[model samples]
Target: MLTISDLDYRIEARPLFDGASAQIASGWKVGLVGRNGTGKSTLLRLIREEVENPTAQSAIRLSQGAKLGWVAQEVAPTDETILEVVLAADTERHALIQESETATDPDRIAEIHMRLVDIDAWSAEARAAEVLMGLGFKHADLARKTKEFSGGWRMRAAIAGVLFSQPDLLLLDEPTNYLDLEGAAWLEGYLKKYPHTVIIVSHDRELLNRCVTHTMALEHLKLTLCAGGYDAWLRLRAERVAQLESQRAKQDAEKAHLQAFVDRFRAKASKARQAQSRVKMLEKMQDISIPLAERTVPFTFPSGEEKLSPPMLVLEDAVLGYGEGADILRKVDLRLDPDDRIAIIGTNGQGKTTLVKSIAERLPLMAGTRKVPKAIRIGYFSQDQMDELTMGETVLDHVRRALPSDTKVAQQRAVAAAMGFSHEKVDTKIEKLSGGEKVRLLLGLMAMEKPNILILDEPTSHLDIDSREALIYALNDFKGAVLLITHDVFLAEATADQLWLVKDGAAKPYAGDLADYRKLVLQADREKPDPATKPKTAAVETKPVAKVDKAEQRRLASEKRKAASPLKRKAEDAEKRLTKATAALKKVDESLAQPDQSSDQMQALMVKRGELTATIEQAEMDWLEASEAYETAINA
Candidate 1:
């Protein structure tokens, strides 16, 4: 629970929040959304500062005893195992356990044990493992040292630690930026069931819509909180904008009529009094001030004049990888026509990139035939293409260098403008540009080739929701075939008509849609066995435990279970209902996302979805209550 009242904040005299106020209820999952460079992250920093050093004049306030948690940065590479790092995140538990070893007083030892039971410390490792697995870590990887993982995996470990800590007020900024589709989807479900208040700043539309209970719009130097998801917020904002426009129009007409009357009658003595009255009425009228609509720059992917023949690119039973005898993907049979729009889907490290690279001719097949017409052109955009850009060079410099030597200055500027870079932006150095700007620049360079097929890998990673929508529009409008690899499900759903699954050393057509694929991913996570449940191999041989010690351990365990049985049963039942309700709601949401449904069917599904949403809300409340009661009973 947090309250921000009349918050006024600025950066170098530029206002980020002016008279902004919001109340976040306990247990509410709030999705903070706004365009890029809109100070969303700054707001989070302010909240963190307020929580850390409370001042009487500060605008942000949290409930007493509420702990705030966030992943400030990626975990530094260390010798600690992933599991140990996550387990140590719960400082209270770790300190208590450490103190228990040296605690000589009986009262203090008893107090530690009671507190551990209250916190459900017995299941801490299991919960940590679940979070790690959902975030794309293998069971074996839990024991691996953090120094052995890459920077991205290290960031995920940081995220897992924060999640496992379960702070009362959790703050997540762009949490899904490093996640693959599978990890993102798993995070969505996990957050839906999180027990405490959450304030997440993200550009991920699917995660916002499916996970958060409330949408917090940060725009025009103000904050507006709305019930429901991003779609609901959009609908409400649209209606408000229309209403304001209508009111303004009516006010303008009234003012015009009053002005005409006053002008005509002010010249006549007989109507002079009426003219004065009309003038006063006009002066008293308040102007309806509507906020200016945010402008989004469009992405252009122009199609070439030449038409390519069918099967413009083909890979027949190809073994694709970095080199000979090092095949990452094999038995791949794929074909791309000039008009195809395909999306590649799979878990991370499943050779999705390898498949795309092979298709784009960037990687040669080791043992299979590849066919392509010499006239066909392919433009490839790698996910890490930004790294290839020279930071010291300007956008115009890159554009000019990428274009033909004969291209005129005007034509170069025109190409840069088409990629959403204005004259000022074109001259700006690459190091000064934002991630989205760099992505736009890369796209501009790619589009200059006038290719028949585009192979784009994770192109939307740095784009905001509006920019992503603009890209979806451009991709659909472009005449060239598109082969996209992205973690953004909304982009995939909007642009791709066919799904290609790259898994298990092969690339093939997937029979289901994006919704079905999401379900499959979530189901896999649910079915995964918790690593904590696995038996550990002993490093050294040990004698069996004494019979008396074993009997005492069993007696204590049985007593603990007996004391919590009733409340535990209630919690289990509530959990079951919540799971069922959530599944039903997901089904309706999936149906609502379909593009080809009839109007009547869509209306029916909308109603069903509304009902299911309410049911889920109530079920969530019941589960929370029951779970708390169970914990209290055990602690007692």
Candidate 2:
């Protein structure tokens, strides 16, 4: 069992954990959750004994004889081979084995041999190999020097090393950050069957919900332990919040009743005793403390055009790849409608990214014809933007370049604000920004286009859970088509309705849910192919609609139009309301900017401005909701 007895920690001058106490059982898998700066990592460091607990009486202790496993954040390039580095995780066993081999004394050699046997040192290499393969490393790659691999691949090696150690407790901090979808799934399964304790810090909601036995949340500078996984914790938390709010409301109402009685009859002789009693009761009443909320950054993607006709894009017998040599994807026939929400998933080094690039017009089709409506605007977020972003340019300048020439600086700032770049942060050079911040800038740039179709490739790579949720929220309200190529199963499951699997030069519709698909991928990867197996056939293409006469299709469209007319009218009305509210908000802001105003006038203007801001948010949210409903009805 792990116990924290009033442990406190601080960063610089700010206290993160103030006498926070929590207990975790021996075998429980804990999910540590909180906001970005709430110090999830710091808590992990504290557990690892790297950070000093400030409370003198605090005791952060684990069970006797318990061993810990921690993966390093950065694994520097070394002369060691990947396999050697992994095997090095068991330093004690390795040292014993070396001593046994070189020892001249028979007694010492026998003792070392017994210790090696106890630790199962003979299977260490095999275990390391298994972990390496599970993390997407080939047999040939295991002997390769760690320095030869890219940063992401090297991170995978580091993860493998940590897993191979198999300590009593494992500290996995975003273990899947650099992992492929297949690798992530494999790791999830591996952790499930693992016998040891695990505490993970991940933004993958599904992973957290599925893997964790308990949740330890750092809220309002205190660690609160809840029994159960992410979903259970959320359910319990919501109920608690509701109960607290209801009780507080009741208490306030009673206090108000007594307050009024005291106010009215305090000076009257007839009811002096009763009024005094009421006042005393009022004084005795204690205020119920509401739960404190951390600062929230509200974000929304810019709204797309109201109208887009299908099919928005199509490819007929197309070949996709970087160059003319060997194609990564061959003879792919695909169509995208304005209502399509497709997620592309596959193994690493496969054709998912290639397909997205082909669709985005970043890579030319090597073979067949492609067609797209001239009026169909596309908003694309590419993985390559991490390298393509100008190091010298500011965030605001990049947004300005991407936006229309007619767009004002004020409008650009609004878009930046939604992107989480304040006026000050906006001026920072791109080179000084973090990977996640860069991705946010790119997302903001794409959002500003307000395109009718969005084609994204690994858009969630560097994003945290909050940003990922914000993106998902925006996508849910988006009326246009979304084609997402991502390894993030949580994001994909939340946003996509259709799943496409890309493998072995073909793209096909996946016939199952994410869980089933993960099984298929992992099974395929782990199981060795047999020569006796039959040759594979082409993937069976499933058309959205069966072939019908043009007249019949037209009739169906006409019927849909008739059914959707009311919703369409409501959506248009909402759009108008939003426009008017925005105009009113602008006028209020303009009035506030004027100098030499009376204090009372300024106060009223501020109140009016606040009201207008709320009005705009509600109006826009309503508009999106109505628009999405109208679109859904028409497509239904």
Candidate 3:
């Protein structure tokens, strides 16, 4: 359990948090949220006491015997092996092993060994390895030195260490920034079963919704703790704001009535005493102010001057990957119409982004050709593309520079306004901007380009909820084709019209939605073979299916039709009878449900309804049997 009371933090003179108070229940998964720079991270730091300011009463109080674990944001180079660092997080086990190794006395050694056994130190290595694997690290990478990995991969190692530690309180910040959707989903599942208090600071809404039990928002220089997940927090926050506005309105109306009474009789003698009383009441009333609603970027992609004909893009038997690299996506044939909105989804490192790049013609195909018009214009939104923006520059300067030199100041102002920047914010430096703001500025610039097709890769990684909603609205109404690669399941489900599954060196259409795919993935995981009892086999190579000649195919088709004709007829007949029986039962039940019906008539109807229901049940069973027979006949 953690309790915060009268928490305050300041920088020099400016106050970040003042008189903020919150109570976090034990074993709760909390998601901390607020606009950028509203001290969400500061609160986390205060809870962990990482900040320099120190005071007893303002400090976070944790119950006795509770352990806390936090993923360090800056995971520097170290001499320790990656796996060793994770395993070392089990301090008791590590210390016991060390003491046991050095102890010459049999009694002391035996005591230390017993402690190790009680702590389950024997399987620590395997558990750490498993966590590293889930976070996209290979078994081979486990023995490697921590300094060998890039910063992003090291951040993943930090997260893996925390998970392996299994502390009473676990803190994570933007845990999904280094994880793909598959890895993030795996982490989500792991945390759901974790019997510990977890507090996460992340922009990944899907992660928040999946793992968090409560939300702690730092807003208006105060803390608002709410029950439920991110969406619930949003609902409660809006309600709170609405309630404030309602009270403000009531206060305004009352003041107006009081002032009117005071004004009408201020100069008259007839109601002098009442006027004085009303004036005094008005003077004593405190002013109530309503906060402005949160404003999000309202920009949409510019419509192309004219719609292109169908087949805006086509890739024939395309092989996709980097230069001279073995194809990760092979023999892919895809066609995109002007109206196509395809979302590419797959596990991490399965080449979803590679497939997207191939479609955008940004990557060269090893074989086959991309058939596209020379005049085709693409507006691509990759997270990496944001790096091209000049740092230390203002958002307005970037947008204006992207436009024509001849574009008027009025038009530029309109563009900035559409990008959620007002006159004052237009000059805010890019270096000082939040992740969401920078991404919004980049997107606003892209939308101003008026391209014929938009290809986005992980577009929602840095966006807040309001900005994500705005992007979804824009994408849904976009005139040209859209090809998106995103980990955001909600955005994919809300915007994409079709889904492309990239796996096993191939890309193809998925005949289901995100929900269906998730179920299949979970079922597959549940059905995975246990390593202890799994049989080992050599990898088998598979050849492409052979094609048959026209005459042979015709003959086979004729045989299949002849075999299936009778069974198909039977199934069709059963289906018709089932429909009729169901309708008859429905009518009888409706007659029996009428409130004004006589008891004798109702009794007769009930008996008839029961008989019809039995008939309908039989028809359903017959239909199922006939359908199975038809399937067997067709296969045979």
Candidate 4:
């Protein structure tokens, strides 16, 4: 158990936390969330006492003899075999084996028995192997040198090592980063049953909701601790935003009233003193500045010609795998349309990546009809995008290379601007681009190709919030068909119109939202509910049990039908408001592009732009609220 009291942390004179206090008690699993530079990692390190000179006013006190295990963001694999690394977790096993080999007395046998019983060694080695295999290490791979693995695979190995430690407290930072969908889901299930304390920093909302019993949000120089997961946090944050809006309106009204009084009594003899007093008081009063909320990225795709029908891509009776091997994905029958925004999901090493690769044409499909429609130009973004960039080329140069025809340098600059590259950033070398920047560059190049179809594999994995939203918006507006492979459930739920359940080395289509799919995937997580956090499902047994099941079912069905009508109306209303705001932003874009815009007209347009920006922001907030209400109603 860890107790953080009035904690304050700083990095290079930047205050990461101020008076932030939270308790991580026994049997607690917390999801620590914040922006990239907000110091979630630093906070974790401070709590583990890995950082020195922590604030005097703050304290992170852990129970005595607490064994801590951490998976740091930057993972380095030593020159040991994977098996050797995993076997290292079982120190008792090694010691016992040593003593068994060299024992000179029968009493030593007693000592060995005691030690084996103490550490539960009879089953621990097998369990460790099970865990490693579950995490996607082949039996052969267990003997491979760790240094030979790629960065992502090495990170996975580090994760396995940490999990094997089975410490009292676990700290995992972006544990899902290197994992495929299947690997991520496996981890989700593992964390669900883990009995000890866990504090995870992750960007995967689905993973957070699956494993975390509590949410800790770092914002505004403080921490907000709450029960439940991201959904609960979103709801609470929305309510707080609403409260701030109300306060802002009240403050504005009071300011207007004070100004009106001041204007009326500025020159009047009797009212002058009262007016001056009011003015002085108002100036001294803390100016109630409205809270500056996060700004959503404004984005819409350009229009293109629509196909006569949904751009269909069909895979028939497919047996896909590498040469002379069993099909990694076998006997697959699938149809994809423009309307089907499918998310390929499964556990790690279960062939999600292989399926994506086969679809993207990066890998050959051994025995199948891979049908792609004519005029379907596919823009495939994958992990290989990082490898495709030339070592010496600038970011701008790489993007320009994607252009089909040789274009003037100025035209390439225009293309870069459309993709959010500034002049200074344009000159930056491809080797120097950050992960997020590389993603942007790849997207910009894809946009230039004017693809009628897009295949994205783990596209959102490296993107920050702003970039993710922008990419989502682009995908939403795209007239072309899309086939996506991602572990981000929120992204899928928000953007996908349909779902694909990838399991048992194949893909199957499902007609449902991501929430439905999530319920299915998480159903396998059968951890016992914490008694401290469990809520009573219904009123206690104060009334006799009713046994009229048929009548009760019919009554409930009738009530559900009755409830649907009004809920539909609310959904329609929200959709209409969102439509109107989207149209207005489009109009602003059109107005700004006018060729003959005069100086005075431009000034007016700027004022109008600000107003429209604020209106769109409010509309988005309202839309989120409305959509949530509609979803809740439907589920209820």
Top lDDT: which candidate number?
1
Model 2 agreement with the true structure over 460-494: per-residue lDDT tens digits: 76667777887898888888899998778889989
lDDT of each residue in 341-380, candidate 4, tens digit only: 6677666667776887777777888997898867666677
Model 2 TM-score on a 0 to 1 scale: 0.76
Error of 4 at 589 (Å): 45
With a 3 Å backbone cut-off (N, CA, C), the pairs that clash in candidate 1 are none
Off by over 4 Å in 2: 52-59, 74-79, 257-285, 292-309, 324-326, 404-408, 431-436, 527-636
Model 3 residue runs over 4 Å out of place are 12-14, 55-59, 74-81, 105-111, 138-150, 260-275, 390-397, 408-417, 421-433, 525-636
Candidate scoring better on lDDT of 2 and 3: 2
Worst 10 residues of 3 by lDDT: 526-535
Q: What is the C-alpha lDDT of each candidate?
A: 0.85, 0.79, 0.78, 0.71
Q: Could you give candidate 3's per-residue lDDT for residues 178-232 as a string of tens digits?
A: 7876678778888888888988887777778888889888777778888888899
TM-score of each: 0.81, 0.76, 0.76, 0.68
Ranking by TM-score: 1, 3, 2, 4
